[model samples]
Target: MTINQAIRILDPDTSAEALGEIEYYGGLRGKEKVLVACDEACRIAVEIMRQHLKE
Candidate 1:
């Protein structure tokens, strides 16, 4: 996919929202918080990629 298409697929705002919710509910701190956020973001990006690839 083109860069624009990838950006649209990734949807940073949505990813931010997901991470915000995780942080709010998870109540994690410091390095643990960073790790969870990164993991969640990666999972979301991978899922989006997988869906687009299927189409």
Candidate 2:
């Protein structure tokens, strides 16, 4: 899937810091997964920011 597509799929699985290792230690090999995580994180962060701003 494209990065954007992965984002849609990934936006829900924000679990443990283990995901970080998948992104960092893996390096270039991990880029695709990292992008997936980042997209999800971005969507989540934006939702959180909006919630806080609304409050």
Error of 2 at 50 (Å): 0.3
What is the TM-score of candidate 2? 0.49
Candidate 2 lDDT, 1-55, residue by residue in tens:
3444434444456433545666677788776876666667677767767999999
Q: Candidate 2 clashing pairs?
A: none
Show the lowest summed lDDT stretch of 10 residues, model 1: 1-10
TM-score of each: 0.49, 0.49
Predicted candidate 1 versus true structure: per-residue lDDT over 1-55, tens digit per residue: 3343334334775646544554676674644664655655567668878999999
Candidate 1: regions farther than 4 A off? 1-28
